[model samples]
Target: MIFNHFHDAYLYTLAEVYHKPQFYNQPRGNRSREVLNYTYGIESPIERICYVPERKTNIIFNFAEALWYLSGSNNLDFIHYYASNMSKYSADGRTLTGTAYGPKLFAYGDKRLNQWERIKEVLREDPDSKRAFLSIFDASEVLQLENIDVSCTIGLQFFIREGQLYMSSYMRANDAYRGMLSDVFSFTFLQELMATELGIEVGKYYHNVASVHIYETDYVQTKTVLSKAKQIGTVPAYPFPPMPLKDNRSDLQVVFEYEQQLRQGTITLKPVDIDRLDIDDYWKQVILLFAVYQSIQQKKVIDHTLYQKLIPLYQMLVQQKWESYFSIIMEEM
Candidate 1:
């Protein structure tokens, strides 16, 4: 079934997958796991683009992961800072061997042909081309015993139909409760970026997973989220502005630079610093949110005004649940 928002789609998938999970074994752990084969399509993939409140999705981690992929980085430091669990995926404890989709998309294999750049070039040359596929799974690395970080997503395919750009992502395996939200966030972000670069309207997104499952360890949490989904009521699709055609690469680069400086203690977090950024107002607000997150981590007082300004944006793009979540974050400080 097609859902208008990502949270609804995720909750629906979780409930269905949890109702009848099959016992199976995975490569990571020796214990038997519960899983299910599932497939679903999102009619408005980018609408209300955040996880359900019950799931307690980390906004910082989601945005940081998306930016990391776009930056073509494989360093554990970048992702580990936001999501500590990412460190476990590293094969040598230094770099992610094969599961790093960023490097694969922007600089893959020995020849280092940037798949994203290639996709843009192909689409620019032929808007209706069927060869606009970005491959992330590297069979050469997956076949080796030393490579432990194999990709879960096989590839992403883009199509241009009726003056819109549609994206379909294929995954070999998916953890319905733990992994699906972040995967969708990153992939759909990529889709929006591509559509913007191509100067076309964003279209529907299709996601197909060969194995979509919730582990036995997460059964209670899955059930809790499912139960809460009912009380959350039906969420309507939130309107989103069309992505601007002008390239925001330089603007994004500036954000990344500022983030790096803040992480390294070279620059102090301040609301005034956000005014120096040349990015769009929305991105400036997003950067400010990041700054607040950093302040929380550093035991500094959060700028309440920034958090207040960000609440409506998050509610519009994510969900109203974030309003309470952000309030809690601030209250604890």
Candidate 2:
């Protein structure tokens, strides 16, 4: 289906497979409602968030995970902080072999090919080049053992048409419930970063999956989210900040540094400290998110002071995730 916003696409796809699946599948002992060759086109890539409260979408993890990919890192220590269970997917319990796209994006296995730079040069030299593609799944991965994390993505292709930059991602398989949301958040962010680097307007995002399915584990929650979505009142789409025009990839190091300190509970950040970060407000907001997570790590409560620093869109997302605590803080103040 072609969709105007990610929310609509998410709800439609989830409901579709639930109500009428092409087939029921158990790829690895987990039963799922599946649809083969499921595909979608998003008109506004920036509207990537699915604000359903039942889903408890973690905006912080979305941003942090995107940063993890952008930083070209495969460190388990870094990602494990956001989603502790992700450690299970690690091949050697340290760095992720298939799940981590950073190494492949920057310096791929064995040959150490920098696909990121190659894609940039490809599009820079010829805007209309169909060859501007990046491969994520390595052929050698076929030999990897079972139950390990393998890349769901096939590759990403960039198209420059009529001065707008569009991207398409092909995935071998995707878990429609949770994984698809994060994957879309990261890939579209990649699409915009490339567009910003090329100084072109961002265009539509095409997501094609060989098997798009929802696992049995999420069936109950899926119904709740859909039921709420179809209810009389539902969450409204908010204005998510666009990626800063600056090619801020170089500044990611600073972001990562502070993120490490936050994750380690090494330093407590006030709103003022976040404001003074040597980065744009767009990025400072991300650091502020880390600082808030720091509070949860060290104190298990959202810091009211730092929580006020978030933009209203983010405030809404965070509030939904930690509603009980958010209300108590509101009452105390």
Candidate 3:
């Protein structure tokens, strides 16, 4: 709860683990320094992206991954397109059963209930009901050793108090570097979405991790990030826009369709074309992000006119991460 944005919380977690790790554990041969029962809160859940230049966080993958979860998909090929490293976690080499919380959150158990709709109903029926929980961990499914894709999230609970929707996510384990970055982004994105569905304001995000750590492999990169922050003296903040105040569930399918098309390289859209789409500006920006990523992947040069169409924050991050590509485009000016 000490940080207003994701950036500070992330740095705090890293500094804590780096300075005073209480334990050590190695899972799948990658050793890590650990801190047990770690917790933090983001006062502004929609301000979810961590835009540190040193780490070069992938905003594109974070957005795509969040949409993937909302779409209730567990397809390895889909996620692997954005993050190829995700393919390694596939239990059957086709889908991610344990790690993919989409199906588990949206449709789970005997009759394949829509847990999100249920949560909305529960909240509408009784706003203060603590039973509004969307669970991801199933003992029988994740207990087996053969499964490599165990989910980091245990469950998410929603609370509606003072006309704001607050969310708390419970995780059995969290890797404080790359894992926390993506986890916080998606979880808070989900938090904001739930708030939109409930017609409430987005409140703070609470993350409680039983085991939080920075993997040994990321130690050097972690140190570099910390050094950059120390030199800067203050973590920067950005006003990440909130979800549109409308029920966007139906439009998710449309987004997924376009996302699939872009990811497959079968279709491309210009910035103007995205603006012309009938969807809300929020989703339009999402599609625009997909277009930007597609341009990067295909190495198709994007001109200044089109490149500047992204929100200033995204433009900053994209240009920073893919400087060479964008530099070529900018130099053409």
Candidate 4:
């Protein structure tokens, strides 16, 4: 979205909105080395590719469609499974498990209202407030799912600037081109819906995925997405309208019921083609990475545990004496 520096744009979006202090209370450096990406140098997946062959807009939309299929479909199942697994509540907020039905509660209103409702509320509270923030950082829900197989949503963070909503998601892992593309599309749609609900005009929809690397095995799919992205010229815009709430109910039961009908006997989600992602537009992402790397280095206050692994790398990059060209490569990356 109209950024002075791509890195600035990316870091701002990645800012933490709601950090659960409990999760942050872990022992420092307990698992720092396990988190570092030292063996994987700058030339790894984090580096920017100069060229790709896909249409930008098509790639963005393809990812959007995939996200729609996932959110509208599996999200409810994730909620149900999580709720059933814990199935208990706690008197103290400290030990509150799934009994409170947080997953089921969050699934209501087509899964849009629960996620974007607070965003709209922030907008309505101050139509011109540039600092409107909201996030989906339900650790308890995610932990329950993690106990079984894998968690769905690692965490989400959103920010509003100049009437536009920007989002950033942090995950323990992602599917490079595929996951990043889908994430961008879904968050952009969510931004549009929140804007519509708040009665405000939509602006830019900025998005970022912290880890844009590839596994040794997924290189083939990753290369295909990159090649396709270079082929695409422009990114597609997803038009997501605001969801209608039934009598202002915040509970997720109604949403789950609707999902039940959508998923009759089998849950065959529409597959998102890897070719739909445009790699050329990802240049901005490369720019943002440099910026984040810089921020991590110059950061005087290092209080958060989430960024512990990045500190050493940040220190090394800062010593390189990188220059203004950092911003120029954004368009080329």
Q: Quote each prediction's TM-score.
A: 0.88, 0.95, 0.95, 0.40
Q: CA lDDT, every prediction?
A: 0.74, 0.86, 0.84, 0.34
lDDT of 4 by residue, 1-333 (tens): 344322223222222111111122112222110111111111111111112222122222232233333343433333332133322223232333332223322353345445445555665676655444443334545453233333333454555556655444445443333344444444444444455455444454433333333333444544454445445432212122223322212222332332333233232111121113232222222222223332333442221222222233332232232334344434544
Lowest-sum lDDT 10-residue window in model 2: 231-240
Per-candidate alpha-carbon RMSD to the true structure: 3.2, 1.7, 1.7, 18.2
Tens digit per residue, CA lDDT, model 3, 149-255: 78788999999988999899999999898899999999999888888777789988899999999898899999999988876555464467778898887667678
Q: What lDDT does candidate 1 reach at residue 210?
A: 83
Better model by lDDT, 1 or 4?
1
**Please, what are the lDDT tens digits per residue for candidate 2 over residues 1-333?**
788878888998999889999998786678999999989999899888887777788989998888888778889988999999999998688998678888889888788989989999998999889999899998878543574788889899999998988999999998899899899999998998888888888899999999999999999999999998886233456767887887777666788899888888788889988777778888888898888888877787889899889998888888888777776786788
Give the count of colliding residue pairs in each prediction: 0, 0, 1, 27
Residue 47 in candidate 3, Cα distance off native in Å: 1.0
Error of 1 at 117 (Å): 1.1
Give me the runs in candidate 3 sitting further than 4 Å from their true place. Answer: 142-145, 233-237, 300-305
**lDDT of model 1, residue 193:** 85
Candidate order, TM-score descending: 2, 3, 1, 4
Off by over 4 Å in 4: 1-115, 128-131, 141-160, 168-172, 228-333
Task: Count steric clashes of candidate 4.
Answer: 27
